[model samples]
Structures are given as C-alpha cells and as structure tokens.
Target: MPHYFLDYQDSFHDLVDVDGRELDNDEHAATAARSMLAGRACLEILRGADAVISVRVRRGPTPLFSVTLAITEDRFHLNG
Candidate 1:
C-alpha cells in the first residue's frame, strides 16, 4: 500500500487533503479521484451553475494523475 493525497477543486472551491489516504495503488487512487469529482460536479449541477471540477492525485510531492469535469451551458445549442 501507498499513501496518496487527493486534492480537489472546482469553480468555487479548492481543497487539499492534508491527512491523505492509504490505498493499494495508483489505479485505486485514480478511481477514487474520479468518483469524488463526479459527486462534486453533480452538486454543482443541482445548483444550476456551469462548473469546472477536478481532482488531482499526488504521492507526497509528486503529482500522479488528474480527473476533471467541465460543464457549460450552451444556449445556442438549445432548441427554443
């Protein structure tokens, strides 16, 4: 097992996981990041605002991977 830090950010907030988590591997960390990003994105969507959300995975001082979700409203694409 390895220690990983999952830093999360979005249109309105930036949070760092100082305590971090102990996981099996990088793959597990990535999966966790994606799940976290999706949950945050859903919350933003419910609030009726466009959002850009991401989770950055890091091992100690080294960044390993990032998962992101960007949502924007395109009024022109909507059929009125």
Candidate 2:
C-alpha cells in the first residue's frame, strides 16, 4: 500500500488532506474521490456549493492524478 493525499479544490478554497489516505494505487484513489463527491451522502453536505470541484491525488510531494466533478453538468472527468 501507498499513501496518497486528496486535496479538495474549488474557486473559494483549497483544502489539503494532511492525514491523506492509504490506497493501493492512483486508480483506487480516483474512484474514491469520485465516489466521495458523487455519493448520496455527500449531496446534502455539498449542495449549493461550487458547480465544479476537483480532487487532486498526490504521493507526498508528487501529484499523480486528479478528477473534476461538474455538478451542474452532471459529468466527471479525470486528469493527470
């Protein structure tokens, strides 16, 4: 297992995951990020927030992957 950081980003704020997460790889982290943002449980919490937000995955100081969710557009796209 490897440690990865999930940073939450939007126009209003940039939140860094100081604790991070231990996952198998970047793909798993990407899925987790998408799930976290798209899950029903998060709907109420994130409702009325930014239409587009991003989850950035980083291994220590190196960025491995990123996923952006467009709530208004109902789309999810991944980036590196």
Candidate 3:
C-alpha cells in the first residue's frame, strides 16, 4: 500500500489533507480524487452557484496528478 495526499480546492475554500490516506495503488487514489471532486461539484450546484473544483493528488511533497471540474452557466441565452 502507498500513502496519498488529496488536496482539495474550490472557489471559496482550500483544504489540505494533512493526514493522507493509505490506498492500494495509484489508480485507486485517482479514483478517490475524482469521486471527491464530483461530490464537491454536486454540493456547489445544489447551492445554485457555478464552481471550479480541483483535487491535487500528491505523494509526499511531489505532485502526481490533478483533476478539475469546472461548472459554468451560459449567460448568452435567447429570451423566450
């Protein structure tokens, strides 16, 4: 097993995972990051606001990869 740090960031918040999680492999860590990102995005949408959510996967002090989800509304819409 390997230890992975998942740091989450959004429009209004920055959460650093001081206590990293021990997972089976890199693939599992990536999946967890994506799931977290999706859950955050859903919460933002429920609040009726656009959001830019990202999860940075890191091993120790080195960044392995990152996943981001951007949600924006279209402002240019035809009037009914």
Clashes of 1: 0
lDDT of each: 0.90, 0.75, 0.91
TM-score of each: 0.89, 0.69, 0.89
In lDDT terms, how accurate is model 3?
0.91
| Residue-pair clashes per candidate | 0, 0, 0
The alpha-carbon deviation from the true structure for residue 26 of candidate 2, after best TM-score superposition, in angstroms, is 2.1
Tell me how far the alpha carbon of residue 14 in candidate 1 is from the true structure, in angstroms, after superposition.
1.2
Candidate 3 structure, TM-score to reference: 0.89
Residue-level lDDT of model 2, residues 1-80, one tens digit each, is 99989888766668998999899987898888777656632663457554667878889989988877665535578896
- lDDT tens per residue, model 1, 1-80: 89999999887779988999999999999999988888888888888778888999999989999988888866666678
Worst 10 residues of 2 by lDDT: 40-49
Query: Candidate 1, TM-score vs. the true structure?
Result: 0.89
Clashing pairs in 1: none
